[model samples]
Target chain A: MNTTQTPCRELQVLSCRPGTEPTLVDLVLSPPGWTCRAGQFVMIRPLDWGSELVWPRPFSVCDVSDAGLRIFFQVVGRGTRKLAGLQPGQKVAVWGPLGRWFRIDENRPNLILAGGVGIAPFVMLARREKTDNLSMLFGHRLDLCHYPYAEIADRIESEAMRQTTAADIAAFETVLSGRIKTLSGIGQVLACGPEPMLKVVRRYCLMHGTEGQISLENRMACGVGACLGCVGRTVTGEYVQSCVHGPVFDVRDIDLGE
Target chain B: MDQTVQLGPLTLKNPVITASGTFGYGLEFMRYGDLTALGAICLKGISLAPREGNPTPRIAETPCGMLNAIGLQNVGVKKFLAEKLPYIPPGTTLIANLYAQTPEDFGELAAIFAAQERVAALEVNISCPNVREGGVQFGQDPAMAARVTSAVKKRAGSKPVMVKLSPNVTDVTVIARAAVDAGADMLSLINTLSGMSVDIRTRRSRLANIVGGLSGPAVKPVALRMVHQVTRAVQVPVIGMGGITSAEDVLEFILVGAHAVQVGTFNFMRPDNAFRLVEEVRTLAESLGISSWDEYRGTLRA
Candidate 1:
């Protein structure tokens, strides 16, 4: 569903789940307004409430279905507090199926990297009925809150997984041994989560000659280019709005970390 | 509907005006909507000299809001006169939002603006810290607010002067009274609140600057209450703004004592939001049998 089809005024809350008390919320919107690629987001505003949050808050679309849209967010201030407490049957005002999406090639095996709630959008893609040959390597502080993904068959690291250099990879390979398949035939890699994990994914992809795209998070005002607020400097030195230019970019085009 | 509003000596064709810092020179949003329909345009905050502003990561997103410390980046008054002032639309209120490090800087800029009849009013923005005056002087104290107001009014000569107050103060009403006593003709209340966002894993500040001013819906209630308080304290009209995105929001401002309201952060979300807001207010007023939007001003109960 392209976002243009959904009018800004109409949105329905389909389901609600609690995350990180009084702070984080996982909500799915009803009657899916639009189709969004893995890295895109939508703007949601609480309707009819005269409280000060008149501008919409941009949230990554954790999952989407024919029934509605789903979002995972942490309640930080007034806006999210209002959003988090909303009842399931209630309505919320929403705008856009916005921003560019991460590209995927069906011909290659997919490698998904997620950290914390950054796993939301990728989980939405992995839940698809037709998706195949997908593997997710997720890093989280603990195992309790790891996202529920039924399709992600292999986990590269879990409670026992630690940051490994080349020597550790050799010793770790002993566990998989002959079962470990080379990343060959993997045309593109998709990763989102924390900047550090993404930094590591970019390096690993390059060392293995695997192509990759990563989703970035930033402080955004207008989920569009109008505000010039949520901007990131590309490798080219030009400032581009993360909301418009992308929450997703080719790993090669970004300067993640020195 | 005929779009125009009267702000003291100036008559604006529409009640929709761009808030400072969001629209740059009023030229940026012109590409998206008809600038002439606006009641007025307040250019980005201008200081005596050009400022490069704060370092990188000037902005960061929160749950339902964003923080910014652009630090009033803009060319000086001379460049504004040379490049920006010429394009002011006839009948549109062209307000120059002046920020300075000293009362003298404001006086000088006001005198420069006074020379140009096209400039409608001098909006003294005392929110920026007065670097030379020892400490955070202008905004925190009522005396400094009045001092800046008096300085600008004196240089403004015959032109009406409006003072835009900072929200960082303890009591906005005290500051409002001081500006009125100092000869200000109008007031714009409640700039962004100071805020910060930190990356959980990195445990570093989300913004390049350690802290920034919070804007958008998060600060609306705080802004509205300040507008109400300031309007009650001062005899001059108040222009209330912060998180105003709809016509109902405008009505809320008017009911709370705002003579007019400015749309700030919403301009970034939807370029056409202001134009739509103006039309919506007019239609709602007519539907309710009110001849003018002003009829509902300051109707808030207690």
Candidate 2:
């Protein structure tokens, strides 16, 4: 397929879970474009009609292999609601390894904080991708509230076994204190999930002088830059759209209030 | 195929624009698509002073749609001209989408943006949710929509003032007629439907904000219906949008009386969808031997 000319391809739905429904679909792309980095996402469409659905729902690239990509998304709205209804082997459309990736510095001990499905990308980043000393702090509504943490644990275990070093990737499930203040430890933290959680994590990072990058979950249309729907204010007071400039950003740089 | 369209004094090479709130200042999406190729790019919604906007979970997805509660986050009028104006594409029509809590605020900001020579047109964004005015606000009410339209038009003077309407209204045509009566040069319909999603398992609102404006393909039929109705009710040209992903969709809107079409969420679906829409409209026109796509604009049958 032509790199720039060909439309981004949709792959078969390997699975679709209707509860907290995370619809996982694979997308096969050509050339260098297929490698969706950590904290990156792809725009997915459930059907073929061009503009039937007003917006393209963005899904976190939960996992990807050389064969294709995976998106972990909840069936929250009209788009996802339709997606959640799809059975396995059904076609799901997708576009791009869109937006910038989670910036990782292997030099520092990595601290991972995931809120619900926001943990999707971190799973990809943590597995096989070596970190100096990886410690993960995951917060959900409750222990079995939502998201695919068991799958994350499996990847971490498998990756650790391959490395021949059982450096425990510490995991936790703490109740939402209405604020993301419970997390601690590690020099650099990567957090994703709901807005409130990311905000608290960001504030904690700023106060403690710890470096952090947060994966922003904003409604996007193109998953590209055509629509300026996902603008996020920066700490520097500049408006940067979350879709183009990032799905991930330095936690301190984002203005979470608006 | 020629993409340019004459909007008042401005001549655009294309009819597809980055609708307000969808494309921030033109400088934001320079890397994603051909910035020069667009007919116009409306910056994020601007107000008299900086607005804090709404709270988070600002966005939530629906079937073929998503809801947004951004609340028009922007650097007020003065800052926009000083910081963002210089960065827009030179020849492209630069429309500043204006929002205000009151009619006076609209007039003040319109006057300010009109003063800047760089701004080609003023897109009065009356569709914003008014936090202060006891919620019986402009844009939702036809009379208030007209009031704000007249205020902006009077301040804008000779500059074309396009009023963007909200789909949350009961009768969009009534509001459209009010805007036209208030001297609007054009009207853009269907700026997100107010909707919400819930996490049934948790029994909570899906978005941090209780409600958000919905946009995407799911809203297309509703948008098209509004465009059709508004075009019949008012004389001003209507710019139709909602879930525009292809050139054929552009033709469909034009046939339904949309003078132009704005590609919103489609931009997120494919970075190049805007350019593709422009190219497809041209190819579609040529294929039909229409000579000009404008001839087909607003030619829809009742």
Candidate 3:
């Protein structure tokens, strides 16, 4: 576990862009001290928000640069709704680059599967890895524009998106399994999505004996491990705190019972 | 302003202490600020053996608070003492919060910390609402609360025993009196209030445990009333906590008769919040012409 973090700092919002899709947003804040690995995330909340929403929302760091700390997210609920209303120069409290990072198995062909807003972190992953061997399989219920495809578009070798209808899902699975079948014995599966989608990905990886890692979006009050509010069970029956042990876990390490 | 406050026989440099279960062994927040600056740091609840806690979806955010049914997932006492305890910085006061299924188990758990020189005090958690066994059961019954207090007090041996009281009870003062009568050196009042949240879409409970203890600013008023009741009902020094986010909240607890205050849910909003409050309280108090905890504690006119 990476205990290193940029302690909470009130950074001014540099820019807030409504995504191509209405609910989606690209929020950038100014902070030079923070850096993040592909899979790591930050806990953030608008400083003005008091008990209106006490707990800060956790978002995967989409990209970080001299420009600002970028986080692409969907305004799913009250927190994001409030976040969407932000204007430039408004400050939000943030602490991050917390949790473990993704370990790219350099030897293996990595297949990344992202669902809807789940594509946020992979933008950083795809940008950093720069591996021609990587491919992205994106699935979402909405149109292709709803997902932040452009941020990650030029980074990977190939990309595909499928609507979440049953037939479309089955087709997506066929294409994913076919790609894994082509790898023979040397492939890695990395995914972040709705639970049901990740469950399918985990099953595919487990069945094919390919190494897999899935980033879990567990609800956490405190981003630090103190709250114990974001625990997930492992294959061995041990409840691991997602905040500390991982927001990302190996498919075999966690048990998604049938 | 004088920041020091006496919590029973244990003297503290300041009134702000991070509550148990929220502070995570006291080492997790090292990135935020100095641990030695706070009065003390109470750790996660420890039992005789390791606990797996509840199932998934253990937390849900509410309007002003959150519901958590962590069920006390913790590394066991032996493991906590072995791996977790040694790493905490020296000069930082460490309070071992104990949780058990029975009075006998409570006494044995207390004895483990009582003999360790690193442990500064024992905070007995007789009130945890999420677990299926032990904690809340012992808390709801005065006899059981008294038994647990006496059992821990017998083995505590000069180390202060602060029995943390639950807010789920009909009359919190009844349990407060029972624990104080049984030999609690101090009392920390108002653990989370038991509550539930539902997802109307699925027609299912938000938390996997269905019900969980509620904490955050939402419970502040309830905590205030109970702390006032308990502080007046018992002679022991009282440490008050529940949804405390700022130095103002810390003073609110003190003004209502708390010897000291603990920062709980606010630690979630900002990792360095409790540390910030340690300084914020000084600034706030100095501006208000308050020089010491003695001048303000329990001075609530109502």
Candidate 4:
């Protein structure tokens, strides 16, 4: 894959809004040549901060437009906290359009399972495809936290769980099984969110005999596959760097063991 | 300015090389910057057989540095020679960083790399802290270090062997002397300091392996001291590294008698750092009125 290293540039922030939660920052960066596909991500670092945080943080490409690329993130750690404080004209070192993107088969019906910020990538996937054969299942704590997905999704189903528990997952799985039966053709399941949600998605795909792809979220030091920090286990018992081999992997290939 | 440096029979275009374990096979960084601008690329550590490495949470961030227990995860020698070697851009000097559990394993790996036409040199890794055995264990003991060095040198054929020294030792010079005595053509110091981190909330170790090798700017002072000590003790050319971030850092190592310098953690910070350092070193050399690196190599006034 041909990846470009975009230097630190002042991205004119279109807007920073509180999406569904107080911690969530929906930021839009209008940097030129910032084209990205769904599931691809960028490494972002604060400019002028010396040695305090040496590594760049990786965030999935939420949405892209002629205006700019949108990154929806929850301020969880020091890096994200610093990013949340950035003003409209401030610059950040952004390097990417990296990693393999979500492979969508136009012929197969698409089922997207997203939780929290994981909803970021699916928005782009839905907007790009503009297909009627898409079904989205979003799990969130509060109704406000749900991404405004009415415009992009063809058939949207959501479950509000304060915290996704075993019971909630079982219910979600039952709903997914029913959804799979109603679809006419062989469908593909794509998932991104918390690891637990992905585990559920993986199991659902296995039981229903549906092909699945998952975007893994691992703590990464270098988003460009140098550090080997973000590694996921493969079914073949080998470890592959999530930054390069994938942020996206076949659900069958990944060994997500407890 | 004259930028080329000689390590045994290998001649590098400049004194800026990418450190092992930091630069993945040299192809990943090509899109980010001009990789050919580098003097050489020291690939990730390669063992006799494929290693799965450590479990999850193999990395932890600390003040001005990071700790990693990657455990020398690589695609083994055979796959590396087949899949990785062909992809390297022509004219780029490639150094194979080899690791093994025993002296015989080291000899076998050396022979494998020695047969390869593309490899410019073999960097015998005697100092990887992440692995449970044969990594820092052989590196810390002078006798064992000498054995590993001799084993590689015997089968290395005409290929030059550079022993990468570990900083986790009582006296780094002892190990340096041992490798040099065993026919090591050049030396690279230091690998990474043994360190660990813990999570306060969970009350658990940060890395799965409990302890990992620490790299980045935090270890620069220690690395510089070791590089200075070892270079003065050994007759062979030295390749200095440890938390080198800028051109000034590269020059400091050169001033301490390093023929060349390797940039490690900084690659994570900026993928084009090695390319940038080539220009920075030239600019600095011109400003200082030093036409050649030889004039200032080890000319440190202490």
- Give me the candidate number with maximum lDDT: 3
Docking class of 3: medium
Query: Global lDDT of each model?
Result: 0.71, 0.70, 0.87, 0.83
* Ten contiguous residues minimizing lDDT sum, candidate 1 chain B: B128-137
Q: Is candidate 1 or candidate 4 better by DockQ?
A: 4
Q: For residues B130-188, write the lDDT of model 4, one tens digit per residue.
A: 88889999999999999999999999999999999999999999999999999999999
Candidate 1 vs candidate 2, lDDT winner:
1
Candidate 4 stretches greater than 4 Å from native:
A1-21, A142-185
Alpha-carbon lDDT of model 3: 0.87
Best-first order by TM-score: 3, 4, 2, 1
Query: Measured against the native two-chain assembly using Cα atoms, what DockQ does each of the candidate structures obtain, in the order listed?
Result: 0.16, 0.29, 0.76, 0.54
lDDT of 4 by residue, A124-208 (tens): 7777775665677776655543465554444344333334476866676677667545442488878888898788777767766
Best candidate, DockQ: 3
Error of 2 at B233 (Å): 4.1
For candidate 3, write residues A1-258 as lDDT tens digits. Answer: 234543778889999988667698989999647577888999989889988688899988888888889988888889989998889999999888788767787767888888888888888787778677787878777787766776677777657666667888888878877765665478787888888888888877778777888998888888888988877778888888787888988878987655
Query: Which scores better on lDDT, 1 or 4?
Result: 4
Question: Over 4 Å off in model 3, which ranges?
Answer: A1-6
| Tens-digit lDDT track of model 1 for B93-194 | 688888888888889989988888888887888764322241236877888888888999999977889888878888888888888999999998777787
